[model samples]
Target: MAQDVLESPLVLLDEVRAGLQGGTMVPYLGPGISALREQEAPMAPEALADFFASKTTLPKRARGNPWAAAQYIESYRFRDTVTLWMQEAFAAPVPPSPFHLWLAGLSLPLIVDTWYAGEMRAALAGQSDWAEVQGITRAGIGEDRWFRFYDEEGTSIDADQAAKARTLLYTPHGCIVPEANFLISDADYVEVLTEIDIQTPIPEEVRQRRTGMSFVFLGCHFHDQLLRTYARQVMKRSSDHHYIVVDPETLTRNERRFLDEQGIIAIDMPLAEAIERLLT
Candidate 1:
């Protein structure tokens, strides 16, 4: 086993930083990375359901499912308005989280934002000229990279000129904007399998840099097979060099087994503390 197999979050963060600086670590961003203070971030599924209820009554089945709630609300009502409202809920007047600012400054070669959100992208944009490849935003950063494989398809910014700026943000689940690109129901989840082409863009430069590297999954929840898949994708190198940071409160027996099976080092701590370790 690697010497870091059982290190504390502090030590683990240090190791991760070394890999990142050495061009051997990829930081995968997720919704969990958001420190949505005073803003409407779903602390839990129920909280999201309650918030969605204010806009339109969500069926009991859709109680804990924001995607379903959002999809259902948009089906009969205004899709653009609903998605924009959800985006605004995140875009509310809150300063960027310290973790994001720290992440933006890092010279990492590549960043894979699973689903789309403009918050981190916007924050990072302030730090560097992050090229948004296949994105969905009102005003794009520049011409899309080769990763924008599908033309004018799901989450394409041109889908709606008035939708919202910096709208494309990829989460562990999928894109949060664009009603068509939304991964809400079961079909949507399965659909991601078919569209795996645009999943993770490893630029030739990034690929070379990633050799024998590790991964640090930020704002990721790894308590189930669903979220576990996110860890597997980014750490596909088949080496025991990846680590997952999840809230200790949410860690489960099943999650433990999944991590062990995948050879992943799991840190049962909150991101705030982990980031502090990295900063100091």
Candidate 2:
């Protein structure tokens, strides 16, 4: 319960330290973090418009709300353009943003992100030298599909390397191994939300093994359904976690109020700036 906890900057950092000791804290990332370097990446509104154009075979609109198109498509086409775009976007590699670098500096135990592949990998590549001990878990398609990835063909981030580095990255939604199985689409997004609801703050077993834990959230826009699902899960599970959510624009009054109310420390800064503050 947020009410039972004391909300202060120093106090919050102390809570993060406590989670480090207790191993209950974890980070839940979102799409905004991807934009840390890809400033050219289309905004959510733009992505929505593009999705509509792709679905209806209509010309892309110069200016229009993408969510409107999303609503229309959901009601009409029921296609997976939004999901496709994310998969394609993440499939390609990009440079690490500041937020990613900041994360590298922190020796947190475990990190959970909604990122697909590209930018995060880029970030990891840059931070590989500093990341002596870390673990990452991703939500893949299904348990069977995920195990197959580890079994049939191993990953570039092998278990040996992971064990040596003390890192355990996962794609709970399935990785590139079974491209088709990678969860996407509005329904897949919904499934991610469902998982957050059911099994989050991660399980206790995971926490005990993880040490110096604190969730340093980066680049995530907290309003999406998937994010909200994670937020609710985090809120319900533990108040001892640390969250540093970065956004380009400063939070609106309502947004600030909401984060303050929820006990989430919202960092109003660009991903580059956030990384600068966190890392070098």
Candidate 3:
């Protein structure tokens, strides 16, 4: 029943920066990070749902819900159709924001990106010490694997090789590059959710890296139940203290409650402003 304290951005700036530099803080990025660049890609679940709706007629109930809209498309049109649309929606290459570039320069052990965009991978292109692991859907794949590891070149690599990297980038929702692996539909999430609570779907390397590490959530909002659940499971067994940059005036009652329950301190500010301060 505790409330998350609204901390002054200036007061926590130094400590947050220090944590990033020391690799004690993991960067948890969301789709909103795409707003840093002027791109045509849908940056949020609602927007993505609209994109699907525009492509094909959707039921009124599925109009604004991405998972439902995607489910409708897969159920009616075909899973391949849904995949093609997803690939087309995120086909445009998004240039990395300054914050992403800055993070790439650091030797952080883990960075969790929940979005499907390849901006993070783009940012790390020049870094040789990093690798990525993305969550794959269980819909079409014949294998029973839940995730796949890739090197800097986008080549598939074993988990052992990924674990040896100095830095690791984890996209729990999948990514566009290398292969178009997306967990957007309800079926995709249902399959993962069944085992996520038991940590069966999470890569072993990610589990080991997240232990005892603090998280800095950038451009993320946990207003939706699905996102809240994923964030909770991903941060499970990690450090108690975490930070999320969000606008105090725009937060819903549920969002505030989620923040409080998770022991996350809220920094009231614009995402761009927060990034500028963090970079400075």
Off by over 4 Å in 3: 1-6
Residue 271 CA displacement from its true place in model 3, Å = 1.1
* Per-prediction TM-score to the true structure, in the order listed: 0.68, 0.57, 0.97
Candidate 1 TM-score versus the reference? 0.68
lDDT of 1: 0.53
Quantify all predictions' global Cα lDDT against the true fold. Answer: 0.53, 0.45, 0.88
lDDT of 2 by residue, 1-280 (tens): 2342334434444554455345456655555666544444443434545744654654243225443454454445444544455455445444556655555445445555554443443445544431221112223323421122121223333334444443333333333323423443344445445555555324333334344444556555554444455455544534543566445255555554546555566444455554453343
The best candidate by TM-score is 3
What lDDT is obtained when candidate 3 is compared to the true structure? 0.88
Judge candidate 3 at residue 152 and give its lDDT: 92
What's the lDDT for candidate 2? 0.45
Best by lDDT: 3
Report RMSD for candidate 2.
7.0
Write candidate 1's Cα lDDT for 157-233 as tens digits: 33233122222222334344323233333333444444444543323333343456677777765554545664565
Query: How many backbone clashes does every candidate have?
Result: 10, 17, 0
